[model samples]
Target: MAIDITVDHAVATLTDGTQLRTPFWRIDSDRDGHHLAMLAAQHGNEVQGIEVARRFADLCAEQLVAGTVTLVPYANLLAIRHRRHSSDLGPEQPGRESQGFNMQQAWPGDPDGNDIERVVYALDAKVIAHSDRLVDMHCWNHFWAAAVLARSDNGVAVQMAEATDLPFVMWRNSPAPEADIATSSHLMYSRGGVSMAIELSGQYQMREAEVDRGLRAMANVAKVLDMIPGEPEIIDGPMLEPLAGNDVVVEAPCSGIFMQSGLEPGQRVVQGLKLGHIVRDDDLETVVVRSPACGRLWKYGRHDMKCDVRLPDQHPYASEGDMLALIVQACGPERE
Candidate 1:
């Protein structure tokens, strides 16, 4: 059966009189079922999800068996154009200075607000509000593995997260405070809809491997929603639960060049395991970085630096107290 496809733009005007237009694709099958909305590039540098959204729309045009699917490939046009986390166009609002004009933090935004907020408001009303389920795609540092982050208390969201077949799944049980309700996924979940965020590895530029993984995740999600055919393929991996206080973050003891100890993300480690070392640039002294607790390494790399682009050949430079690695506790099935 032929599917119906509609293409439209979410239009908003910036403070500088520039028209901010974001295009979205909506596909409807002959038989209606669930509505799944996929969004990417909420953080402009996270381009992997943009490819996933585009490819998934194309796939739905040909293989959609039931229901509706909406794709917003570039959810934040200003950020994507600048190739940064957010656009620098907005005036610095107090408490939001570091975030700039990030769209992910502007959920259900105000139409009369600043540039990013207006754009987010338009997108929220025109696309997100109408959808029953949402997948907000994002990217992390290259040193981290791809994973699905979802609310543990939401059964449907948890099922969707597991269906992605990713290497890891991180669950949060607490309800988001109204003031802290920043992400679109959280906004949708608050409205009693299923929502999850997929974090692909690497940002700024698209990696073929990461893009392929994202595509697979979208397909698996479609299968689970029955928008496409077949059943979701589940993979065996760690279902991580956040520690009570905070993650075991191994930080550099001194300002130096960081060297890894052959431990990669997703690797299990014991307490006091040596993760890496830092060679102090000032005194030529070596300081070892170690895991503070037994858990799976979630991320490992230099911290407190702007990672808007890929740095394949650049050596990781770290300062004292800069994060070197993050260890997240693995939880058993009992937690579920």
Candidate 2:
């Protein structure tokens, strides 16, 4: 028999005087063994995660038989509201970075710090401390809607990823040298809990396939936590294990009108294949973009003049030295 679940919403105030609200769905049953916290849209442009969180909130009302589930669909409220990646701290709170401080990097934030910091503090005090496991939904930059990557160091995180029954769990320990234990997931992991980050395709626009995959992964995560009833229905698939590291950023060699070769993430390519081109608008000369190695396409940024607007929203034009694409070397795995 199904159970009766109730939904509730809570609000919090940031030091910068930003008030944020979140929704929690509670299922009162004897199976209360774990607590799961999900954060979506840490980057405002990423919306597929929110859709996944919403679908889980709707289905888990009855599916969650044991523990409680807390879902914060929009972690950066001001960013999402303004349709920007960083928070709307305005001129007064100018961040360290030229554009602004990314919410993901300003973790363990100062109470008297900037707007994002206060918000992070609120989430840490209210959400991270109370959860047994955390699943953070995020999207890569405006690139090819690529394959999914599940990242974690803790066993519980790995278990949660397995429960999501994703085909292949790409465990990346080699983040950029700058990666550390300051982000929200890192906070949860440091406190002896498990946290996982799910990167589901490109940002700035919503993709239906990406949203469905995310929903399925979360459903499995709940099952792994024993917060929800039923066997995890992880669809069979191929998992991409990182060889060197997860992110292999390719930068544009020169500034020009970018043109693509119809290359996409998830497309397998051999070495020397032409990936894209840059045309000098003045001379009408085109340069060839080629693959340096043989691997699957993990991500590729699209251009405004190139990307198909038929998909609702196309990304902006690429600038010189911008992140052109990210390639996850598909090779051997299991290394610290």
Query: On residues 260-284, what C-alpha lDDT tens digit does candidate 2 reach at each position?
Result: 7887665665667788887755566
Question: Highest lDDT among the candidates is held by which one?
Answer: 1
Off by over 4 Å in 1: 1-6, 89-100, 174-181, 235-239, 242-264, 267-296, 302-336
Clashes of 2: 1
Give per-model TM-scores: 0.77, 0.69
Question: What's model 2's TM-score?
Answer: 0.69
Per-residue alpha-carbon lDDT of candidate 1 for residues 31-61, written as tens digits (9 for 90 to 100):
8888899999888778898878877888898
Worst 10 residues of 1 by lDDT: 89-98
